[model samples]
Target: MEFNFADRMSDLKGSAIREIFKVIAQPDIISFAGGVPSPDTYPVDALNEISQRLLVGNAAAYLNYGVTNGYPPLIEILKERLTKQGVVKDSDEMMITTGGQQGIDLAAKSILNKGDGLVCENPSFIGALNSFRTYEAELFGVTLQNDGLDVDEFKKTIKENKNIKIAYIIPTFQNPGGVTTSLEKRKKILEICKANGIIIIEDNPYGELRFKGEDVPTIKSLDTDGDTVIYVGSLSKVLSPGMRIGFVVANSKIIGKMEILKQVNDVHTNQFAQALAYEWLKNYDFEEHLEKARLLYKHKCELMLKTMDETFPEFVTYTRPEGGLFILCTINKEGIDSAEVVKACIDKKVAFVPGFTFMVDMTKTSNMFRLNYSTMSDEKIVEGIKILAGVLKTL
Candidate 1:
């Protein structure tokens, strides 16, 4: 029997990396396919203590359904943090989203209509790509350079295209591409988008994990106008992804609409998780936890880069990220299919996502693949790369 679905659901499918989890469930897969943080970094002990206390002291609030805007205490705490970052202002309002991903989806839903124009990096975050697609937004992909999104092409695209409503970008340690947009480019992109009246959705889940290079201010921080950018951030990297603690800072008008959409969507984010996240942030040494995670990831990234340099063929050039979970490798030689390459690695008990999974058009060839360094052990990372390099050599 055939089942008909809505137009928005017509082309949508499960996430590729998520599907990889099912296949790599075996203990020996040495998987590098997920954009996940290392389990070692979770403050499990502190969370366990917090959970017990919350259940004992405020069990009613923890179990009861809360408002669509999220738990008030958590929202206030997150607002304070964003304020210090200089991204949120009195004119701006915020909401605590289920995760950074939800913030991206909600922001897109608030402003985009069917057939509206959308812009993104050529190889952007797969999750954001799929979210924008759900709105049936016509997406324009700008090629990403080593430093960031191609600014010149961005200006050209905006000038040529009409009805382009939003520009979604992961400026720092970008997913799949592992590139950070430079400071100058950030200002220029903001100027161009503001001039053209395009909303900028800045997804920043990995900002606090920077292990190298100088920190680049977010586009929202640079936007003194305060109406041009929607800054989305998540504590998943530093704290826990399971809690789904994420926040969005946008103009009060946009946030008000998004809050209503949130009311209809899930009614609210999980109240218990919000309480847990709030207690932890207010009482714990979050900065200490963050510093430790940063150091661990820094070591892991350096190790992965070193091993790739030694094992992979020179033709397979990859990004050396300042900080992030991924390093995207592009096969310089022609006629190579990345899908086939991924399969070969799987056969060797090593797995990674094909680069096409993150593209605006998956049918188009990029000859690139992504490797992760944050979830696996030092030994496994070394072994996986050695095995993967062997497969690439035979190509």
Candidate 2:
């Protein structure tokens, strides 16, 4: 027998980053592709202790079906934590998700209708883009500037398309692009979106990973009235990605609806994972843990930057991110495409993601690629860049 799938399934594309992971699974490959947290940074001992306590002391809570909103104590902790990050107020409501990725999916499902217009950074997070696509939302890409989304282009896009339902952004240490939106641009974006009555979906998975830069206030922080922003936060980077704990901060009204949608999605995120994460948070020094992660990534980023400066062709330009896991490399050679470079890197047992996947238009000329420096060792980082540079020489 043959099976049929929904028409919306055709609108989605498989993640380019996931596809690159399959190519780099070979032991010999040096992967600078996935934005994965380093296993070295996970607080394994703390997690182990937490797990033992939970199993020995509170086994029934983990075994039973849980509330759709999440574990209550976990939700309270998230409210306080997000308040410190400037994503929400003490009064603002929050919901724990399976991961930050699920928060994005739930927001798209709860708020968007078919053909609704959504504006995203030109090179945005592919995961969020895929989530929006699954709901049949028409996506529009706005050019990204060093400071933030191009304000002029953003204004123009809003004017051109009045049907825009949401403007999604990864303002701090953006994925793939590795660029942070400036405070001035953040305020300007807030003004524009507020004026247009557009909701801003702020996905900040890498905010606490800063090593060298001054802290920039999140856009959600600038929202005095709480009418226009939906914020997402993740423990994946700072705590444990394996546990897959993340949360969404929004007005209570919106969060109430999203909680219902999340119930249908997976009942709720794993209760045991929620309890474990809370225990870890309660017992561990989160600031010190974050600092260790920052130092490690900073060293790796410096290695990649130094290698690129010495080895890549003069035409190649890349962003020097102050923090975060990735750097964006654009090979400006007229005939060399990013896809071709990625293929060449794969052939040499080195991997990076081609930039076309991050854009709304696939046919556009893309000489860009993304390199992640968070997961590999210093030796692997240096070796991968050297191998990729050798590939560039041939191009």
| Among all candidates shown, the one with the greatest TM-score | 1
- Model 2 residue runs over 4 Å out of place are 1-3, 363-365
**Which portions of model 1 show Cα errors greater than 4 Å?**
none
Query: What lDDT does the true structure give each of the candidates?
Result: 0.90, 0.88
lDDT of 2 by residue, 310-377 (tens): 99888889999999888998888787679988987898899989999889776675889999998888
Give, for candidate 1, the lowest lDDT window spanning 10 residues: 357-366
Which stretch of 10 consecutive residues in model 2 shows the poorest summed lDDT? 83-92
| Leading candidate by lDDT | 1
1-395 in candidate 1: lDDT tens per residue? 78877899876777888888897898889989988789998888988999999999979978998988889999898889889989898899889998998999999999999999999898888888889889998889999899888899999998899979999989999998888999999999999999898999999999888899999999999998649999999988778888888889999999999999899888898899999999999999888988888899999999999999999998899999998778999999999989899998898899999988888887777699999899999999999999999999999
Any idea what lDDT model 2 has?
Answer: 0.88
